[model samples]
Target: MKFSRQILSSSFSLDKVPGWTCPWCDKSAVSGKKDDFRIIESVQSKSQHSHPEWEPFRITGTFCGTLICSDENCGEQVVVSGLMEVEERGWCDEGEYFSSYEEILTPLFFVPAIKLFNIGNNIPIAIKDAILETFSAFWQDLSTAGNKIRKVCELIMNDKKIVKTYIDKNGKRKEYSLHTRIDFFGKLKKGEREQKAYGLLMAIKWIGNSSSHVNNSLTKADIINGLEMLHHILELLYDKDYMRIYKLGREYNKKKGPLKHPLFGTRHL
Candidate 1:
C-alpha cells in the first residue's frame, strides 16, 4: 500500500473540528491547539493464506490522521484516513494473496471495523515493510509445517500402494497383475483425527483465519497465546522435547518472572 499525503492539513484546533477523535486510546481530547500537528497517511496490503507454493502480495491503502503528543508519557494521537479491504480476489504486484473471489466479495468495511483492528499507533519507519514482515514470517513457518505433513502423507500412500507388471507372449510367455485385497496400513494406523500430523496441519488453518480476516475476532493477547500453543503442539507432533520452552522457563524461574503458565512457569522466549 502507498500514501498520497504526509501532512494532511495544518493541524486545526480541536474546537474547529467537529467529530475528530484519537485512534489510539479512543479518547476525545482537545483537538484544536497551538502545536506542531499534521495529518499523515499510509497504504498497504494484507494476505490470508500462507501456502508455501503460492506467492504473497501487498495491499495499498491510506491511514491518515494527526500526531498529537510527541512525548512518550502523553503519547496520544488522532488519525482519519481512507482504507480499502485487503482485496481477496485481485492480482497484486507485491504478492500473491489477491484471488478471484475478492472481485465478487464486498470490499472490506474500513471505518469502525478498522479502528478495532490494531494498526499499531507507534508509526514505525516502514509501515508496509513491518506488516509484510509479520505476515511473511508466519507464512514461512506454516509452509514448513505443511511441507513436512505432505511428505508424510506421500510416504504413507506409496508404502501402501500395490505395484503390478506384465510381459508379452512373444515366446509363449505371459505375466499377471499384482493386486492387494486390503489396505494393510489402514489396519496398522489409527484414525485420521487421532493422528498428531493431521492435528498440527489443522491448527495452521486456524492461525491463518485469525490473522487474515478483519473481523476484530483475535486480540493481541490471543495471538500470542495461540502462537505459544502452536509451538508446543508442533513440538509434540515432532515427538521431540521442547528445548526452547525449557531453556526460557529456566531463565524466567531464576528471575522471578511476573506472568506464569502451568508448564513454562513464567519466562518465555
Candidate 2:
C-alpha cells in the first residue's frame, strides 16, 4: 500500500490537522484534539521576547499532543511531539489582503509509531522486526532509520536462503555485501517478478548505502521512497494473492480471452 506523502511530510496545524495512520489498525486515521496540544516556548525564544523588535515569526517552541484513531472500534491512541514555529500567513478579505502569524508543528517523534505501509503476515519475523524498527526510528533519526532499512535487506536475503558467505577461488570464504546478495538473488530466480524485485531491491540498497555514510544527508522523503519500494518488494515476495492475480493476467493476455478450466469450462473474462 502506498502511504499519503502529503500527510507524512506536511506540518501539523490546529486549524487544519493532518490525519495520521493508526499503527494498530492501519485502516483508520488518527486526528488530534485541539485541547490536547500543549505548546511550551523555548528558553531562547522566551529570552528574545524581551527584545524591542521581537516579531511573532521569530517565536519558536516545542509541542506535544495526543491523536486518537477515528475508527470507534479501534480507538487506538498515539502520542506525538514536535517543534512548533510561527510563520506568516496571508488572507484576502473583500480584495484586501491581511497577514497574520500562525503556529505550525513539525513532528519529530511519535509513540507507538504510525504505519508507513501494510506488512504482510507471510513476511519473516526477522524482516518484520527490522521494518518496525525502521518505522520507530524514522521521525527521530533518519540515518538510523536508513540503517534499519539496510538491515531489512539482509534479513530478506536470509529469508530467501541467499548465501551471506561463499568460498572464493583463493580458498577463502568472503562475506557477500547486500548489493552482491541482491544481485545473486536475481541471478538464481527467473521470472518477471524476480526482475522487478531485483530492481526495487537495488534502489533500496543504494539508499541504505548512502545512509551508512558518517555525514549522510538522508531526508524523510528519501526514507519514505525506500519504504515504498520495500512495500512493493514485500508484496512481490509474500503476497500470494498478488502472484495469483499476476499469473491470471498473463494467461488472459496470452489467450486474449477468459481462461478455461477443465471441470468448470470457460470462465468469464
Candidate 3:
C-alpha cells in the first residue's frame, strides 16, 4: 500500500484529528482521542514566563496523548508522545492580517508501532523484523532508521544467494560489499524487471549511506522515500500474485492477444 505523505509529515493541534494508519487493521486511519493531549512545560520555559520579552515562540514542553483507530471493528488504541512547541500562524480576515501563536505537537513515539506500508507474509522473517525496527527508529532517529534500511539490503542479498565471500588468489576468503553483491545480482538475470530492481536498490543504498554519516543531512522525507522504494522491491521479488499478473501481461503483449488453452479454449482476456 502507498503511504500518505501528508499524514506522515503533519504536526497536530489541540483538536482530535485523523491521519495515521492503523497498525492492527492496516485498513483504517487513527485519530487522536478527544481532549486527551496533556502538555507539561519545561522548567526553563516556565521560568521565562515572567520576562517582559516573553513570546509564545519561547514556549517549550512535552506532550502525550491517545489515538484510536477510526474503524469500529478494529478500534485499537495507540499512545503517542512528543515535544511540544509554539507555532506562529497568520490569516487574512476581511482584507486584514492577523497573527497568532498556537501549540504544535510533533510525535516522536507511538506504542505498538505504526505501519508505514504493508508488509506481505511472503517476506522473510529477518527482513520483516528489520523493517519493523526501522519503523520504530523512524520517529526518534532518522539516521538510525536509515542504517536499519541498509541492513535490509544485506538481508536481501543473503536471501538471493548472492556471493558474500569468495576465495581470493592468495587462498584467503574476501567478503563482498553490499554494492558489489547488488551489482552481481543485477547481472545474474538480464531483464527489464531485474534492471528495475537494481535501480531501486541502488537508490535505497545511496539514502542509507547518507544516513550512516553524521555530517550528512538526512530528513524524515528522505527515509520515507527509501521505504517506498523498498516496498516496491519487496513486491517485485516476493509477491507471487504480482509476479503472476506481470507474467500474464508480458505474455499478452508478446502474442498481441489472449492465449488459447487446448482443453479450456481461449483464455479470458
Of the candidates shown, which would achieve the greatest TM-score relative to the real structure?
A: 3
TM-scores, one per candidate = 0.21, 0.89, 0.90
Candidate lDDT scores, in order, read: 0.35, 0.86, 0.85
TM-score of 2: 0.89
Candidate closer to the true structure by lDDT (higher is better), 1 or 3: 3
lDDT of 1 by residue, 1-269 (tens): 11112112122222343232334454433232423223222222333244455333233333233435333565665433333223334567776554542111111111221121123233233432333333223212433323333333233234434222235656544432111211333344454422443444345345544455555354434433334443333343232234455555677887688545455434432
| lDDT of each residue in 120-211, candidate 3, tens digit only | 98999999999999888888998998999989988988998888998999999999888888999899957666678888998888988998
List the lowest-lDDT window of 10 residues for candidate 1. Answer: 101-110
Ranking by lDDT: 2, 3, 1
Quantify how close model 2 is to the true structure by its C-alpha RMSD in Å: 3.0
Report RMSD for candidate 1. Answer: 20.1
Candidate with the larger lDDT of 2 and 3 = 2
**Candidate 3 segments exceeding 4 Å error:** 94-96, 262-269
lDDT of 2 by residue, 1-269 (tens): 46566776788678887887788888888888789799888999989987999989999999999999999999999999989999999999999999998899998888888777778889888889889889888878888988889889889889989989989999999999899999999999888888899899999998999998998888889988898888889988888778877877777888898657532225522
Q: What is the lDDT of residue 52 in candidate 1?
A: 55
